[model samples]
Target: MRLVAPQFQPRTVSAFAIAVFLALTAFANPAGATSPSQTPPRASVMTVATQDRVDTRISGLHTRLQITAAQEELWQKVARVMRDNAGTMDSLRQARASNVNSMSAVDDLKSYGQIADAHADGIRKLTPAFQALYDSMSDVQKKNADLIFQTDHRHSAKKG
Candidate 1:
């Protein structure tokens, strides 16, 4: 007997997307390290449909950053990259929902690798836009962005 449900609603997809986003934001960086030397390709190519799930994230960042009218352009660029990343990830998760049961072990590994690659590529596409926005941010905004992106896991149990 099947233990899991068959179809995922849009709401479920959105919740999963947001969860992934939070995980990414919380764990992607360590110790304020420098970003990659290569910048992503021009911002024009990475645009995707702005899903409501991802839009909410962008809205939160906008409010937190206190983005000025002049900074709106850079903010939009970064938000576009974020939306594109989230859309790509959500699509991958949905695709896996059905096929995962049938996939052979090797095929499952390969599929997971592809998903990881997609996530890495999305980060690649996202960084330059974020960097540009970071450059334009005010001192207060920079502090806020730093806190938002950096994750401190000191209390999570040390393994010596």
Candidate 2:
């Protein structure tokens, strides 16, 4: 039988990674705009989505992932990158809160650019770790890994 963790949910891993990937890209753009109010709501939704995906990934894995030294190191790097991105994410959120329901052209462009860059950094930090995790897993585990993180949120939540 295939070894799998009972609490593991492969869907979670895939979903969360995908969410993070998507949000990081959406929010990292610098050209994004809001009147200092709408950023929070946008950021909040993004943050919620980010957390959900992480939970999904962690809960979905069946195999006992051996966290190697390199993985640990990568985690630190990811953490730092996340830490760096947090402000931009928050800023974007705040901007959304300030500008909710109304989107401007010039400001959104700036904010979008910032959000994209921040997210790019976040992806740069963690995506390789995901690949590493995939590499460490057996065939079955690898198969499930991709199945977890897909979402329609990306298309629906278009960047302003």
Candidate 3:
């Protein structure tokens, strides 16, 4: 059986795409760095800001899902997975950024493969926790969840 349902694929793919874009673009160029030699300061700031955004998204999702007292534990599990996945992606992004200027074409492709692998691993880890929470949801909550995912997918697709 598929780990993810057909309806969920677009949302997952869109999220992954956005994360990849952000990771790559964060290191692309600085608007007004005094010197090309400067690196860590900007990248560090971006990483912290990116992590904050991840946290905000998780909190937003929790609110949007209307998670209840009983569901809190399951919701936390899902949140933890999300945070961990983001951390993994951040690490990968940092590693790639550190060597980005010197990377050969093959190395660049390999770096992308690492990102893709992380995405897949994240989904693999996320699916069951989300499924458990989803199964526990009331019909109204489930509908809300579905709508949120659908809406997010559309928004991300438009941005892409």
User: What TM-score quantifies how close candidate 1 is to the native fold?
Assistant: 0.64
Residue-level lDDT of model 2, residues 27-143, one tens digit each, is 443433344323333333445555554344443332234444555654454444443455456556556555655766655655555555556666666667556655665676445
TM-score for each prediction?
Answer: 0.64, 0.45, 0.73
Task: Give the alpha carbon lDDT tens digit for every residue of 28-94 in model 3.
Answer: 3222122223222322234676678767877887898899999999999987777676666666666
Model 3, which residues run further than 4 Å from truth?
1-46
Each prediction's whole-model lDDT (CA): 0.55, 0.49, 0.63
TM-score between model 2 and native? 0.45
Which candidate's TM-score is highest? 3
- Candidate 1 lDDT by residue in tens digits, 46-153: 223325546766787789778899999998998777766665555555455546656666666566565566666776777678779888988888887665543222
Clash totals for all models, in order? 0, 60, 0
Candidate 1 segments whose C-alpha is farther than 4 A from its true place: 1-50, 151-160
